[model samples]
Target: MLATRLTALLGIRHPIVQGGMSWASSNAELALAVSEAGGLGVIAAGPMYPDDLRAAIARVRAGTRQPFAVNVPLYNKRAAEFLDIVLETGVPVIIASQGGPKAHIGRFKEAGVTWIQVTANPLHARKAEDAGVDAVIAVGGEAGGHPGPDEVGTLVLVRATVNAVTVPVIGAGGIADGAGIAAMLALGASGAQLGTRFLLTPESGLHAAYKDLVLNAGIGDTAIVGRGRSPIRMVKNAFSAEYEAAANRGADDAELDALFARSSLRQAAKDGDVAQGKVEAGQSAGLIDKLEPAGELVERLAREAEAALSGAASCIR
Candidate 1:
């Protein structure tokens, strides 16, 4: 039921993908578990330098033989260095986000690596398709971190991207279960990508406190902050509140720099400061219930999608 060009191209048994969360989602353990479980797992390259990325890639290799991907933030100053490391490591896939895919298409093609670009708008999706990338992942406003200002929902984005291009489209933002996956495929997406859902998995490197926050969150608990310049969607907390206020007041670079000088996202992830630390999570946080193994999570999602599809067919008949 999960069969699609995306899955076939990625060589994964399931069409589920784990969105790369920079500081929190790059751990090798979780990446390997997702890959071994039949989904394409992506390692976040945001917080790492070239050497660090190489080490992390090596760690993933140690855990599983299945193919996995590395995410490269195009806006990063060290993008070229990280890209070079990915090419050198023989990484099979790369997920490009935050910038134009056309900028890196040549490198990906030269390296013979599959490129999956994350886009929020249909226009960007078309651009990625024209650039000859393997696939496009359309993430809606419900996603964590930097969702675009247009902020289309998952259902809308998926359908729009599907209509706009012939390349495979992966649906993201607010997807957590088999029903969501089935719905995405029915809407013409080749696969579904989940972010907040996997944060609660046992293999995830998120702090226990952060994991607890995700488990207890409600539908409206999270809000978008830093909208105009550095828009970021995160769990509602003291830090987010302060950031939002600053952005609202049009805090200049100097003021904003002073405000964030001592604030460390990585430290917060490790220390689990729900109130003072920045927590990146999607609106789907409310839908996730318990912590389970990554493999079991993927299996359940695939089985659920199959059942949902079967049930839908029964209704049609």
Candidate 2:
């Protein structure tokens, strides 16, 4: 197994962390499977109601005593309630994002909860570390579901964030397999978090159509919409095409914002409205070809990473 700072900090066997992708990871199934496989699994709290969040947390706890996390995007209106549920349920780890960790992180810290902040840039990583987070996940624009707006890729962003902060950095974005994991560890990241790769797992909560689209998507099949506002990377489809055409014609903020708000990830995830609903996914979708069992994928990834690292070292001798 891969042992690094992330593994030691979280007491997990591998340094691989499942990305708390909304819709994909909203349920307890994916998180439970990964954790049972000796990797850190995370329940995404973004699209869940308070009751559902509480229920999911209970399910994960009931499923495994292993350390699992709940990702709560602070920008959501129910973030406060989600945090309350996380604390009330005694969830061991909290992965926070989309807002500064100064205020509420203190409360979680007081309760002896391990805090991991998701940052898009080096500056945010530094701020989160200073705010007392145990570690930080630096996700670049190549990731899905609100990657860095600055459009930095994982290579430069993770290295820069590592230099900018002393805390263990978990590199994310455009990572799909064991090779990606080895690359992150080589670049000084203690661990690697995978979003899109995990989405292809059978345990993920994605709709059948949603998974199919991502499976067939190529490297260039994804696009980034809404620059300078709230950029999202997703599969190319009718909705993205319309947005691009509007932007090309110089649409104003009001028009673009309305268009953006009209679509939702839930539409695609829940209702199978892939053409119009925001099918949020990372560019790594191109790398995914089939659905694998989450538990098996984690174990396989760890072995492959170990082999890859060994191969790299052997080449030197």
Candidate 3:
């Protein structure tokens, strides 16, 4: 039993949490499977409307009796509405990202909901702590979607955040296996969060082509694109190249809009267009080899972490 503050707080058997992915990780089947496997599953609430989010939450609850979290981007215009829907659904945990007012944190506290905030640096972690968050998730540049500057890796970021805040730290970015989870715990994190690993799981709703890319990608195959405007890590392709070139050439707002308009993120995720769509994934893609059930993935990670920790102990003696 890998007990930690997070495991005890969330009532999970493992100290691993699934990172929320905008379009891919929000699916009900994957979320339920992760929870059933004894890890916390987070439903990505950013890309869905209020009704859709409620429905997804219902679906997850219907599938698993275990607790789960809903990730809401604080920067979204509809964040308040989404929060209301989440509260209405009686979801126990809500993860807020992208910075929100302190009053929002207080609101969640008043509602008796556990609030977690994601930070890319220690400064954000400190801010989240000050805002009364129950925990902070520190994501490094190796993460997918919008990562901060590439100067800090997950190890450094997690350690720094742990030092800066009294709240529990959930380490993210480039973590896929039990070895990674063990390392995070050793580094003072209460838990580990993963996104890329779950994207390749059979329960994920991502297109087969996208899943294949994750399974086949090697180390360094994932690149950070649009560093200045919308820094995102993804598999390199013609669409990414075009977007990067346009950003480099100083394309104006209209030009950039046209360039971005040509590519569709949802279409790519749903239709499997490797060449013309935006596929957000982390550098951890190299570690994923196959699409298995989410429950199997979670169970295997726990066993692997236990074995790794035991091996380390034996070596020390």
Question: Tens digits of per-residue lDDT for model 2 on 46-75?
Answer: 999889988898899999989999999999
Q: Rank the candidates by lDDT, best first.
A: 2, 1, 3
- Model 3 C-alpha RMSD to native: 1.8
TM-score of each: 0.93, 0.99, 0.94
- lDDT tens digits, residues 141-206, model 3? 788878876548898999999999998899999899999999899899999999999888888878
Stretches off by above 4 angstroms in model 1 are 243-264
lDDT at 128 for candidate 1?
85
> Candidate 1 residues 1-317, lDDT tens each?
47888889888999999989876666687788899889988898988777778888998888888899999999989888888888999989999998987877897798799999999899998988888888999999998877878878888888988999999999999888999999999999999999888888888887898888878888788887655556667788888778769867888977776665545567567887878877778899889878988889999999999999999999984
At residue 189, give the lDDT of candidate 2.
98
* lDDT: worst 10-residue window of model 1: 259-268
- Which whole-number lDDT from 0 to 100 does residue 264 have in model 2? 92
